[model samples]
Target chain A: MQFGLSDSQLLLKDNARKFFASECPMASVRRLMETGTAYDAALWSKMAEQGYLGIIFPEEYDGAGLGKVDLIVLMEEAGRALLPGPFFSTVALAGAVLSEAATPEQKKRYLAPLCRGEARATVAFLETGASWNPADVRVASANGRLSGEKLFVTDAAAADFLLVVAREGVYVVQTKAAGVSIELMNGLDLTRPQYAVRLSGTPAEQLGNSEGLARGLQVGAAALAAELVGGMQRTLEMTVEYAKTRKQFGKPIGIFQAVQHQCADMYLETESARSAAYYAAWALEENSPDAEAAVSIAKLYASDAGRTVGNRGIQVHGGMGFTWENDVHLYYRRAKASETMLGDATFHRERLARLVIDAHGALAKSA
Target chain B: MDLNLSADERSFRNEFRTWLEANVPRDWPEWREKPLEESFDYLRAWQRKLYEGGWAAVSWPREYGGRSATLMQQAIFWEEMARLEAPPMANALGLGLIGPTIIAYGTEAQKKRFVPKILSAEEIWCQGFSEPNAGSDLASLQTEARLDGGHYVVNGQKVWTSYGWIGDWCELVVRTDPNVPKHKGLTVLLLNMKSPGVEVRPLRQMTGESEFNELFFRDVRVPVDNVLGQVNDGWNVAISTLMHERGSYGARLHLLFKRNINRLIELSRTFKHNGCPAAQNPLVRQKLAQCYAEIEIMRLNQLRAFSRITATGIPGPEGSIQKLFWSELNQRVQQVAQELLGPYGQLAKGDLLAVDNGIWSYGYLRTRGNTIEAGTSEVQRNIIGHFVLGLPRSY
Candidate 1:
């Protein structure tokens, strides 16, 4: 019922916000942009040591055993700070997927080490031109082998392991495993290092059957939505700051009626994104029957809002905002990339249309 | 740093949420039967209840018997409580505005006496800043304060003070010198609202509430002890309180939207134009979608403000951004509610079968005050553009 966060959740969130504000600032991130690697390995490890890497998993599996809502809180702060790493994928997708689909033995093997931040993993699910269709699994996981390509994988270049979804089922593919090839791409947001990974008959451990893949993908999508919720928070903050400090026409541009109105609009987008994200995360935690639909709605709005708020950030910053040195670009790129990560707003809208159309039998609600 | 909450803070948040769920009902009271005075009483009683429960001053200092909760915690309290559509509380003309100002600049006696009363809503308060001619140019106010033997005599008129008529006291700005810049030679005073020679004329607003007031002062006299800060230092004090006030009230954008949840549900259930539920209409759906999106961003901005406050101890001028962002959102969201009903929306409150029983019409009229009330939207953008973003300010 707490639409936002609990008091204790706020404490954790503030701690994370303070840590990132001081430790992984935009200045530090800008300094590391061309470093080719997104994350500060030592810092990432420290984050892991803090149990952020396994925020939502089971305590028995060495997790904090906090709910996904709590992780959503951290993820938002992480987004606010633009903490450069494989955090979104590792904490959000891999950990959540394993929790949803993995056997107890699998959780003991992956979730515990992952929670402790000793190992980093990501989901390799979508192929080129395929974004939101979790059922679009052409890559096959059969006969103890995995083969398929996952494009636009965030931080795949620096990952220790990859959890790949395939036609037969879900497969665990290590970055260094045999028959696996990775091409590090020039990402829009250097903070979130992305990759083009091609796996051909890679030695893989199959986690579950096709049904399991379905379940894992849903978890991953929901996690992505939650991660996006975080990113949108950062976008709004950065833009607001930019609006305050950036000046044009002999005074601060935010003082202008037009600019302030635009900022307000952006704020609205980010606010809606927050609600959607929180509701989605909360639903998952509550085990609501409507969790899937809520997750879809959350992801859809967040992706759209990520782009809107991210762009508005630049608008608020104006010229200096468009420059490469500003942290605004960090959020901007992330928003653009993330908007289409699991799916675009339109894609989610289509998905939502399908849901309502199916569940209630098509009432022509679209107009 | 982890984003987990401390067990106690978590408990505080849950308890607050529970309290709001149980005690603070957000339904707009019966307008005619429950007038603005009644509304004020409702709020005052609720504040005392919360103050007794020790939830009233979520962000005030501990010395004042406030919980002085972290910024994020305060924000979390507001956000969660707002989501429940909780009924109004005795808001912080004192706690958020005067209390923080006094903390920063008040004499020990002033702090000891006024702060507690403000927290407990023991005395209702209002601001006497804007004169008929000195709104955006508040520094240009001609409300004169002449220093007499051990007392200051004030003569002036102030307008548009919300929650003003029934207030027990007034935190006001008065001019002490005319031979200086507009912003200089000013003083802030704490005068009894019921003081002799003080008149309060309530202004009924579109929302069927007389939340705004016009105050007239004729030789209002108060001891030197009533001074808030240094003589002729009212501008700085006012600025500080205004910032805190902005931050506190900036959550209004989404808070108002959340209050409309029932209205939205009703509009969805009944506002028919072509045949389908207005909610089913794609345009209305789009409006809802857009409204939903804007609400999310407002929430995120709110979270950012809370996080910043929690992390930094005192929120900086960035509070202006939240203020600016929210004021405009309130304006737009209310517009959506009105437009959702088409021509039927044109019906005023008394019209039959009016949209949401004409609640939205009241809302639309009331929402007009959003951008205007807490500094005009134009001024807010200027603040954000000039102060926060370093953008050019419109003259």
Candidate 2:
């Protein structure tokens, strides 16, 4: 098994880090976190222009045709910026859903625009409490008009379209279409926006059926895991740097064994997150029989690790971490928000348990 | 770079796998009766098999019967062994730490006598480094070994000696002179455990198993030939042992807990209550998910170590990072397994139907000593943050 990053993965990561350090200002991150807006439109366009939004999609579809690792690099830098809105939800989720489950016709229509960032869409999968069970979808579908409410829909209010998961199937519905409604919800962290979606007879085009939706959700969940892995790594890296520069008790806090140990643990945490994220990213390379299990495992790791490193980042930064202005707090907020966005850590854990059982049974039969 | 093992390496790994399978004694249930003795026997047997197969002494010179295998191959061998569920090695003290130190600084006679014996497992060994007062500040060890004529009259105590009771020999650190800094005036001694006045008292731990013992040496005699390096200059020798401990050039430690996590998920499914499998519970699902996450992370940390070895042929102080994470993950996984058992977790085997066959409690007890072994997690983290990450050193 390949145990480390490929050269392209490393290059992609370095390039994203260079770009973010240059283009995405800390002040801009602070502003976005305060405003609860999606990323700056101009910068969003810049990412699109750089061919980053379509990183995990096909080159024919206007994507960079990169692996999960490549997009992961972008996600990490984006986390460093604490850029608000739906870069992850739309590009990572909506785009992934289209790439994975959409029919060829659907992909030709929606995938191209999404890859190019000409259109940004959000996923309405989590009905409540940030869980990712197909059964969790309260929003129902009937007569090509999807109705019911989707809760905690990340970036729902701002997106031009909604990729809704419902009992009837997975459908694409315009946010401004008939009977479509969105209400912004209060979130602990403002960097990522959330919404409550009420789809009352909203005109919709079905993209994938339940199975298709399940596959698509798997893709989205995995991509989100990859993103969180990146986020946790950069967040920890930034916090460690902050620990070195910040002084306490007449010495840099990093000198204290307590601080050093905490930073070391963060390093371990980030590394752990990276492994799962990278493996999930690699799943996009080939949708083999093992892909689903790999993705489930990865998502489980990233969501939990993202939250931990996020909280730890703030802790390592001390008082400034609690402040509204510091970048550390921004990452902490992203970690918290990312957890609930694409099925919290607990949801994937249960899915993993089921998969393990099923896998064991299969092995038993074969034996 | 991509992490593909080369064709040659792949073949090497396949050969190792085949060899282990063929050679692993059929009776693993009785392999290591005494933690120390069993480790020694199994390791010696394994080492002999490797030696006969021309695979032993991975990092030694060609003349010394070593393969000089690539660091990645060594890592692959360890991983493969873990995958195969082999018994633990016995001569780690000599092979991983002290033997490496001897090779680095020992005279030709010293190397000839010790290295081959260590590989053949002729003499089981334990570390006499950490003392009652000196652990993290290891240089402060007070086990005095005074040079008398051509021999050293050693007297004092070395604690936490893993398998000392079963060990035939001990790799010791003793104060040769008290006039210098704590780090200075210390000498490394390869002393026979059965030597006069040597005592090994088992100290039972929270796990109910005594993995290590408190070793006391009251005026034991060590020959001049037993000195690993120069008199009163062992701090440097000890440093190399620590380095070898981090690098792949050393002996292998069987980290078998990852398998436990996999097996646990399976057992949880079979454990049904109220006409439903325990796996159906959302809480069970979540804990499994979290365990999956822990396993992935643990694997990643190991991957980092593997990556460094792939390029540099050496594991730096950064090796401490992997060691720390693995230990912590082992502890956490065991902890979670019990926590997931709910109230039934409290019952052990043969206690009115233990939860999930009492697997969680068994695991929890076995891993209790993990945090203290190799090196404490606290000590490891400090090393990583400072030595590797370039943070300032704190006490």
Candidate 3:
């Protein structure tokens, strides 16, 4: 079986890299972080114009009728640029949930605006502790009314609507609806802000089923894995360049075996994470039986690799890496934040173990 | 990016599976016994049977009496073989290493003399590269091969020679020009194991098995025609042999790990911890799950490397990445299995009360070599550093 990306896919990736580099440089990320803006409206519009926001949406809904794999390619570039926005929240999470679980009328009303960049939305799944367990959902929905709080809801303050995960099912609640309170919280990753939203008897529409919730998570997690890979790839490139130019003693520090090994280890981590991420993206796109397992595997590896490689990126830069003036800390913060989001490495590992046990049944010997 | 096998490949796998079911003996040897000669003979006979069935050397080209399977089919063959928990071919070194090298660099006469015999298991092969002093830095090996009259008088020693005692031929690497640099002075000779001055002493490992041996050559005489490649180019030939040795074998090793983990999962269900099934223990379950993920990653990484090989004729330094990951992952898996076994883990293979006949215990000990052989973890990291990462050489 062929595993390499198609020629068109490769061309899209190259174009995305150039676009991100030229359009949304790290300076824009720093600017958004410093100004306390939820995101750059101009850049969001530019991205919508680039057809990235609708990369995975069907063309019938004013979108680019591409696959999830293509969306991942763009997401990777966004991550490399550290593009500050709710692109992941809107496209990968809420967008996926709507298309997968919503009725035709609901799609026309909800997903169409999201596809056309007329509205921003996000999925508010977890209530409190950073647990991704389905059983951890505590938001209650009954009789077309919603009352609960969603903690660490990403980009909620900037979104037009929120897909709230509730005990009964998912409810599409408007952010500005009465009896709703949205509080912005300072997060470890300044590039992507988090919010705490409280809803009290807010009127909402039922998505009818959580049919695609798992699919949504898989798509989201795979997208995030690609982002982590992009971040790590840049970290490695920066670390390598720094090592070659930065001299210590009589030669470049890269010549030192210890530093060289650290760089080598980072390279290994980044490449492995990329491989896992790519496979997960492809599997999720194809809806393969192994997609869920592949997502966990990719997320598990990328979560750990992101943190380790990012920390090593800073470590190799020595004192400069510790400073806010240096850009390495930006990726390090993003890495730490992303490592626990959706699910941590340990959490994914436990999920994977359960899957193995379930699949083996009597062969597993453990209930 | 389709990961599923194509129709042709699937059919090839089915045919191979049916053949195996029809031909493979139901009762196989559980473990090797003392004096090993009978078991070794049985193994050779099995290899011959496979060769006669045209299933041996599936990865080799058709001109060499092989099926010329594509990389994917070769991978499928190994995967199915490991799935059946099939015994390794008796002439693994010949089939995996020497045969490929000979095809790449041997003379017409050399190919005619050795190729078919290797496939038929009439002549088993072993490698003679690593010396006591030249382990990681193989080019520093001081084995001497002086041209005397019409023969080369070889006097050197090779350690960690798998199947040395039983092999009919040794792919020997020696220095023919002592005055030149370490890498340039070497030569490769197909040494007859029955030579007058040859000696083989088995080395006992931590697993209590003498699966490997040390070879001592005291002026073993070899005809000049025995050289496989050009004189003083043995270094390149040795590298070629190593590339073949490391390539695509990961698929087979991955299957073996998958099978062992399946067994461990079964054991976890049967075993108890804190008065409940051990599989119910969150910690043990997490450990097992971690093993499963790592093993899957090992397999996926091999597929990625396979893709690279398909794109480029050669496997690039990415082999070092998979090499480092899988070797370490294999050990971690066995460690998890041993931990799951609890008190039963300490039992030896033949102990009366041992679980799975103490296979886990033996496996735990045997995996110690997983990191050390082929290439040490340190050496792999070095390769990644210098070759893959373009870092300055530590040496």
Candidate 4:
């Protein structure tokens, strides 16, 4: 009945923290975000060397066989470092779906290259409607050719392949294939660049069923929640540090009850989000009965908490927090973007309502 | 990372479940329907039955008449109690706060004298720490005790004393030295409620319940041997009791929130809203789902706290976090209840058309004190700020 990380998981977390602190610090993140791709190939390969690219894939696919919990541990560290690139889109989103849906042949062909960092992939889930629901997918594929647009496709510009969600099923499309074009979007979170991918009769291969895609979305939501937890945590630390040093009214602003309580509220939100995120990751790993509900809960709570902690973080920093020169705004931007990426709090809350109402409705009927 | 119970824990849970299924009073809910004062005998008897069944104080050491259960087993015990809707133990303060303090700081003689009675509900205990002047600033309390012969002559008053009216013993903190610092001059004494010049006046809360009282002590004498710890270190002793209150109440509170939420869900199905069942309303569903998520988070947060305690033999500042979250969350839940039930929610108990015997209304009022009692939300935030976040203490 323990709710703590295992010895190996703790080691993984510590090593990930140290790795990000050294390899992908805020300076490096800033440097990369200014670039068009907002990505560093060398950093990608280094993470691959560290086995993070395959942290959740099975060993049969030449990957490190770890669970969703382990993936979250890495994702959280990446989030703290604000590690700019396609790590989330490549590994957490696309990799999760591929691992869940791919056959041995498909996995060996696509997943192995991803594990080795030879290729990067991103999931093209949201359509013009900007809904995460698979049922909202309007892009149709006929005879393994897709012709439609996928919106808010994260890291699509940096990806070698795209997992396009179409009306038929999830399709794997080569990003450089004929009739496929990627245009970078004006994303608020510059750290993780997004792109609009337009596929016109693009040759593709069907990867998996909608059920598998749905399950993978849950994993993605949980993973994003973990990332949000990390962002919230770092924001809290930054806010607390700023409060301790930023003097106002002849004393550190932290000495004032107003500022102190705000910081405390940040701590509360961050910690609560962490609990939700970690539990979601564990539930998915264990195939717990509440895994679906837990994932939505995590995403819902983290989506709200991330924005809140960011707001408080900026508020504590006063003028400095509002400027691009300071790193606090970067976290704030990422929080806002991430809040809507998987499913915003409102979206997840409605999803949760469906789950709860349906379950209770069934129970009432059976009784 | 593993949340599944081990074989031993499962067996222990099963054993307790069996006992509870067989022994739990069938008419316990009926007893609860009576006034709080009238229900004491039933509650006390229930605790005694648990003691006789070897289920009382499962987390305490075996030498102290407990089963010496592991933390997981203790958690399972609470979970099962909630599952079965078992009556609450009459000596909750004795078992949860005073008894643990006695075990931590009591002499061997004190343990032998108090521990058994606490488990058996032979004696009920109340905390006498907060005074009128020392609600949040407890160190500023003026409850004074002067050493007289073989006893301490205590004076001054303690307000908001839970279970005071029926308490057999009082864990009283008094200022033993006025010359020293306010925090340094205090002492904790085990005072008999029957002592001369002691008074307990019922304090009616907004819920119309006299669950708490104002305790006045005009030279009430407490024996020297009744002092729980050192004479001038009552501050530390009281802190320990408060920590216990904050840290260990999570599991029980989780069950309570769970029960209330389930009831709310059931009512939402029957209650009308905008020409439909409230459960069918999109807004109400969102509110209920949010409450459900928070309640699940509460349970998970409790596990995290338990994990920390298991890893490190002391409760960390996470207790303050849980306290702050749950108190505010309860208020939110009650507010949602009002929104869902409308005017009927405001009906008092025994009202002809009151929903669920007006429990939602009672809860709506009772939960108002959750944030204010134990510690105010402001005080909790201060604790989290100073202790958890390393923020400078507010002046």
Chain A TM-scores, candidates in order: 0.92, 0.91, 0.96, 0.97
Better of 1 and 4 by TM-score: 4
Residue-wise lDDT of candidate 3 within B225-333, one digit each (tens)?
9998999999999999988766756777888788788778877777888888888888898888778777877877788778778877776876678778888888899
Tell me the tens digit of each residue's lDDT in model 3 across A157-263.
Answer: 77999998888778899999998999877889888888889999999998855777878878899999989988998898888888888888878888777888788
Model 1 CA deviation exceeding 4 Å by range: A1-99, A104-206, A209-302, A309-334, A346-367, B1-33, B37-124, B148-151, B192-210, B217-225, B250-256, B269-273, B278-312, B381-395
Candidate 1 structure lDDT: 0.73
TM-score of 3: 0.96
Indicate the residue-level lDDT of A69 in model 4: 84
Q: Assign candidate 4 its CAPRI class.
A: medium
lDDT of 3 at B389: 70
Q: Score the docking of each candidate (DockQ).
A: 0.15, 0.47, 0.62, 0.73
Scored against the native two-chain complex, candidate 1 gets a DockQ of 0.15
Q: Write the per-residue lDDT of candidate 1 for residues A1-367, one digit (tens) a residue.
A: 1234668897998898888877787778777666776767788877877778878888898888888778778877877777787887887877777877788888888868888888888888778757557666688765788877888887787788888877766777889988889898776777787888998888898774336555555556666666666776666666666666666666655666777667665655566566667766776777676666667678777777777777777776778788876767777787777778776766665555444432252322322
lDDT of 2 at A301: 70
Candidate 2 per-residue C-alpha lDDT over A20-50 given as tens digits, one digit per residue, 9 for 90 to 100: 7667767666666566555577877888887
Better of 1 and 4 by DockQ: 4
Residue A156 Cα positional deviation in candidate 3, in Å, after optimal superposition: 1.5
Where is the poorest 10-residue window by lDDT in model 4 chain B? B27-36
Q: State model 2's lDDT.
A: 0.73
What DockQ does candidate 3 score? 0.62
Report lDDT (Cα) of residue A349, candidate 1: 56
Residue B352 CA displacement from its true place in model 1, Å: 2.0
Full ranking by TM-score? 4, 3, 2, 1
